[model samples]
Target: MDGWKVGVLHSQTGCLALAERGPLNGTLMAIEEINAAGGVAGRLIEPVVLDTESDENKSAELVHKLIKEESINVVFGGYTSASRKAMLPVIEKSDSLLFYPIFYEGFELSDNVFYTGACPNQYSVPLSEYLFENYGNRFYLIGSNYVFPRESNRILRDLAVQNGGTIIAEKYVPLEATKDVFKPIIQDIAKLKPDVVISTIVGDGIMDLYSAFQDAGISSDEIPIASMVTSEVEIEKMGHAAAAGHIVAASYFDTIDSPENAKFVSNYKSKFGQNMRTNMCVESAYCQVHLFAHALNITQSIDTKALRAAVLGAQFNAPQGRIRMDVENHHTHLWSRIGQIEKNGNIQIVAETKGAIEPDPYMIHHAAERWQPSLISGVAK
Candidate 1:
């Protein structure tokens, strides 16, 4: 087996770095562990990392450089949908592969990329259904001005409308906006008095938004803010009070009770530091690497065409559950779980699906169907 060089592109310094850093750390940890375990195909994996500075244009430029100049074959990284879309053309043009590790708005499929994150069906649908069931029908929507939030809100709005619910208000803010900017939005939310607030805000903007909510004397108990993007890491950074009681729908949490998760959390903390936290993106990043290793073992080459065949339908006992790549859509099946942030900066998994939920990136067809997946048998192991 010949040595395989891969590219790792992520935002190390910018608005999105708060979230992107976790995936970067997770990917590096996986590479280190794989190298320790006799390497992939007996050939040490070489990673060429490039910081995109959280800029979409920069991401595309760097990806082109990685392929044409760096001569890397397979690559992994990209936290935001904009960043991923920026690199998609480059990846496709270069005939390379990208293993994207963050959950995003679907309605997209590329032969040049493999998505290891949750799709619309895996996160948004379940979350909306849960809110509709547990909360009331009236909802307020807010998010960063971006493709992911806008698209996600579109899916959620369709689901809410189909289920006889109403979207009281919809709003958006710039990606780099601060908390002071959200004060008016918080006031509007208070006046609307919606039963739930669906927030799609990402990156550092989250800190300000959550803080603004708190300052407005709004608590999750009053009008709980539910999100598909918020994670344990965000909660930790926002402080316990700012995020407590907020509901988040995701496929993985740090508090998942399982031997595999325990080992994963332990190893991550040991490698990154005790102060560092793990979230859905981090777990997906780590799991995707192992899955890629399995694919590499089968294909024994770095060619994107061969690797795609090898990756299709590959399964790994991930920290979340048993996740398998979808042969038809190039996505991964994942377990859906709704978590509430506790005061200790940990998410308490209040509800979860029984088994792996199939990927459905294109939500255009799923709007009329029920969003709930099969219920969990009992406590998640």
Candidate 2:
């Protein structure tokens, strides 16, 4: 077998760089580890890196170049749904595979893309149920003005109303907007006094939004912010004081307690440094590389048909828990977890599903009640 040329297409310098960098680092780390272990199938994996720079157009352009010019068959990166959509056409035309490692709004299926992250039903639905049950029945939605945030909020609204909750208000801000765009939202929160703020805000905009909330003297204790994208890294960027008491739903956290997770965390910190933060995206990227290697081993090639057939229903003991790629939808079956941001900017797990939930990207199943439990103290703030 010839050395496989892989494409690394995560943005390294755009508005979403703060979040995308984690996945890029995770992907690189896996490559290094795999190469050190005598390579995959005795063929070294070579990476051709491209900076999408958080631009959807640029993401699409670069993906086409990777497939055509660089001859890379497998691409691993795309932190946001907008970027993924932008690249979809090029991927489909070329029949190349993309290993997307971030949780998204779902409702998408592509033969050219292998989704390694949770779908809407995996995080958003469960998170909505958690907030509605514990925080109250009123919610205000805010997010970056993009495909992911918009579609995610739409899904959340449906889940909330189905569970007998109300949407007090909804708003969006440009991905690269400044504090000015968030001020009025904070003001609205002050006036409406909604039970909770469901934020789909991503990237650096999160720091601005959280800071504005604190500046307005609106504490999470007043109306806790519930989120699917806000991670420990964002909390650290927003500062402990501003981000504390907020709730986040994810498939994994740096604070998870497990022998496998501990070793994963230890190894990541040892290589990246103890201060670096590891979140869901990072872990999924790491796992995707291993999953790809296993598939390549099974098929002895990176052909789309062979790889997909080999990887369908593939199981991996991820840092979060045991996860599997659903053969039907090509989405992942993941464990759902709810965590409250602590005063120190770390997440404390408060509620979690008992096992890995099946991927329901199309939302055909109604299992929101599965993750909802009796309100626990210190969770709803």
Candidate 3:
């Protein structure tokens, strides 16, 4: 809506800077397109952008200000789980809506939130199945010291063990850890010799980890690396030579071949700049804005509760593919794609799920599911 204000919360100057900028830009792009095409419901979407600075505490404060002071209707931002978690209390207390657009570990559900992103089913499960089928049954986990990476690794480890894969080494490094710090970790990994390395390290940590792995002579051809967070945005930051041959799983990529995506890419390049790259987070933000617009149009109102109700079980043909919100989990059911980072900084979708996998936030199907349905159910209540 032309006069409607939305909060754009992201880290424009911290560890998540590279990852968050794309989505923020993408959200802006969607808003611009909607405005140019006669706006949403004859209202132009105006975003009051706030910088979280990759600080969880700062994010919480910003969310409070955005909701209370700015009186923004919805917040759509944050790249890491930590930032989202930090903003949760504020959102819950204020009863404000947050459309979080990022794939994350499945163990959370909130009525005050619309997670238009992949959960475990959209990434972990499919990736685990792929590794089990193609690669041998040995794995190692590496990640930044954060809730998303830790929880993701736990789920991955459980999946690997359940699927007859063995976890040889699991390590975590602080988000700001130096490159030399990972050398010994790489040495340990080399000794343990896992068949595949599943890494969740983000930002600078990823550069260090990958560089260490390469310097230690641990090539992807020898011990392939698969990551949940590394995407076109991060790969571009790390440079092609450093990221080549690594596998990554996500719901969207810049290279997706579809008429809708082609148009999206063309429009994105034109709006953001030809040198800019698109990634899953950006696509998810774009999808979220469109979905929100659809809900508003269908209901013809911006009542938070009504919008939530309208969105709960809604499905939309997003640019990436068809996506539906899982009422039980509050996460979007989406198709997962496994892509390889080529030497040219482009992703090649090597494999994808046959259909959209339902988001299982409570992990009902897995035997060692860490979260209880009651926890998520209570949170939503």
Candidate 4:
């Protein structure tokens, strides 16, 4: 039995670098941990890393190279829906598995992939209830022009209107948009004065949008930019002082007070850097590797067929809490938490689900009542 080879596809240098780098770090760390502990049945897991450079087309080309040329059957990476979609046909045709670790708008599912991130029901639904309840119903929507932000906004609009909330405006910008692009949005935000600025902007644009708001002297206390994509990674990069008071909804945060998370954080910092932080992407990336290792051990084979079966109904005590891969859906059941960035760049959990919420990828089972009782208050904000 030879050592197993897996592909690590994450954008190293690009607009998405700030966002994708943490997951790459986490994936490598987890592989190291498994290999150190006597990797899958004594065969080390070899990761063939690639730099997608945050380009969707490039992501597709590199993934083809990984599978056909490199012969990697298992791959772990992907930050954006666009990249994932671009790689989908190749993955499905080759019958390989891609472990995706970023939360995204849930509308599609694939057989050749294990989704380890939160779906909208697990993130957006609970988050919406909180925002409308606490921050008020009128929301100003701004997002990076892409499928995810657009889909997420659709979900938010449905939820908002159902709850008698209103969307004051909806806007989209290019991924390469500058801070100046947000100036007009700020003007409208001030004029309309929505109760909350709901932002789904991704990549470098996140920092730019926040910075523009800060420059405009817009107080978050007056209208915080409650975000779906911003995490400690962005908060850390954007500076704690600048990122403070903004909200983020995800399955995990760096500051979750739990034994599992504490250990994960400690080991991660020790390996990466004393100051390196973990967010939803990093935590999920780390957990999926462990989950894959467990599956590999149980089946004693890396065959996509055996693994596809073994990975289902798998459970791991993740940094966020108990998480499970749904046997039927292939989407992870994950904890939901809404956090506000602190002055020190930590996302302080303000509200959380009682337990890991079920994934509703297609939103077929979605209902307003499902989110109401799931979340409970945490540290006072």
Candidate 5:
């Protein structure tokens, strides 16, 4: 078959498989849709998928292989911040393009990568504001002991202090920590009686965190756990009872109302499974492919420079809405939303931006009169 070969580098197995598979599936679904619609520039997008097995070294290695060995130009993958960091040097060294489809702890940017997920300003600031307004002034920050968690918590801590709120306590546990590791933290939360728990925990370890919280008999309504991390993908693994009533700040949810979203969700479920779910990351992956196709059709070349030029100012009618790539930064403009995780792995959105919010990756531009801080410490929000 005459086609363009793109590399797929997300995990399909191992620890993060539950959440990571959704992104890979979404990428494939979009490629299939584009192919069925006569392909990009009349040639199918043939993806060469490589599973990283949730390993940082593996991520870097696979990206290198895709670029160096396979001679692929465009790739889509990387979930954890660690994986992105691990894969960066290789992505830049070869001048290949990587479409990262996850919300991250901002502060760093690359000429070789395009960020499709929400920027820190899009997810973090609005989420912090919502929590402080609806929940309470006292906050407990917790997350996995990794780049994303540490950086995410740094923003939350500052926001807590900036918003007339106080950080009661902050903590981090291992990525592979079990429920036992969170028992003590739960004890501290119970004792301190913070109004809300702002968790940035990621991967399978977060299930342990939520399970520990549930085992403690602590209800979310009384003091909810808010995060940009938890999504329908994780909730599906942890079960509705384990994940219900929690808060999630994101760019996309299956419950979003729009013809584009309705079709995206229906197509995704039809391609994957009826029991499957969608989230911010999955939607970003799906959008990235369509955007890549759009840019490819315009530029008609996989040359990184030409493709980058085409993508930098491109726009696509995405599942989240009509999103546009930032002309200055490579990140995409996206809708911001805060939703509560409901039963059956659904997210009930509580707060949302009126329209697509532009990219402010450094978190320096979208300042409120209340927030004069300039993110000088490399914090995400």
Candidate 6:
């Protein structure tokens, strides 16, 4: 059988490296497993890796080159919304398949992309409901200045007001800005003292924010932090002491107690290292490969159009649990898990939505709904 080539576009340097490495490693592991099991369609899968260097323009350039020159069958890997958005035009024009494996703010759907990450239903809605049900009516919002955080916090703001919760403060720092160095904003957080803090900060900025929150003597136990972007991998880099006791909501965690997860953990540790941390992105990337392989096998070909159709409605029982793609929005159905960070840099799952939640990219029920139709229609166009 002929070898099928796929491209891995990820940042090995710059801000997103910490998040990208785990997933990239997971993808490699998946490739190894597939090859061991006689490869996809009796063809060895070859991943052509390219470092985006966390530069949006560089990522776009490389993606364009990969699609046109390398003739990669599918492209995978993107950690941030900016990187994904940067590659959109290139992939669309080339009519290439891209398996994006990170969660971001909803309101995007495309025929050229297969999103295996959480959308509003898999992350934001469940998180908002969890906060409202447990903590009373005051909330604070914080994030890095970017499309994902800005859009996601908008939804949070709307949800807070809709559910009778007050947003005491909303703050954002540039991607390269450090939260610890910003004294005035730290002072403001102390002043508002909201009941809950919802953080969407990403990259190295997260360490600064959490450290500053700690230095300001704000206890997570008091004004508990419920973050959409924090994970075990980030905590490992920041140290468990900085991230300990914080609550994080996502579709997957490393500590889920299931045989599938247990084997996944064992295999991952064996392949990577005992100290390696697994997060939602890693699991999603790993699952994406297997899911793609499943679809390819079912269709019995690697034809782009056929594969896209197969992926749109594909369902699989992944290590994280059952996942299905929602045809309308091109997002995924995934179970939401809320985990508390432990001192050992591990997240312990405290609560989980019973089953996979359907993706709602347009967010039809929120005040944001007014803008959804227009945005989705434009995307469709």
Candidate 1 local lDDT, 176-206, one digit each (tens): 8987889889999999899999999887888
TM-score for each model: 0.96, 0.94, 0.92, 0.97, 0.94, 0.93
**Order of candidate numbers by TM-score, starting with the best:** 4, 1, 5, 2, 6, 3
**What is candidate 5's lDDT per residue for 113-164, written digit by digit as tens?**
9999887888888888887777888999998887777877788777777778
The 10-residue segment with the lowest total lDDT in model 2: 372-381
Residues 1-381 of candidate 4 have per-residue lDDT tens digits of: 678899999999977887888999999999998999988888999999999998989889999999999988899999889899999999999999999998988888899999999888888888888897788999999998988999999999999999999998999999788988989989999999999998989888888898889888988889899987988888877887789888899889888899998999999989888978888899999999999988999999889999999999999988899999999999999988899887777787889888898899999875666766546556666
Query: lDDT score, residue 183, model 5?
Result: 92
Candidate 1 segments exceeding 4 Å error: 364-381
Candidate 6 clashes between residue pairs 3 or more apart in a chain or in different chains: none
Compare the candidates by TM-score and give the number of the best one: 4
Residue runs of model 5 more than 4 Å from their true location after superposition: 370-381
What candidate 4 gets wrong by more than 4 Å, as runs, is 379-381
Off by over 4 Å in 3: 367-381
Task: Give per-residue CA lDDT, model 2, range 131-189, as digits (tens).
Answer: 76677989899999988888988888887787788899989999787999998889988
Q: Note the residue pairs that clash in candidate 4.
A: none
**lDDT of all the models against the reference?**
0.87, 0.86, 0.81, 0.89, 0.85, 0.81
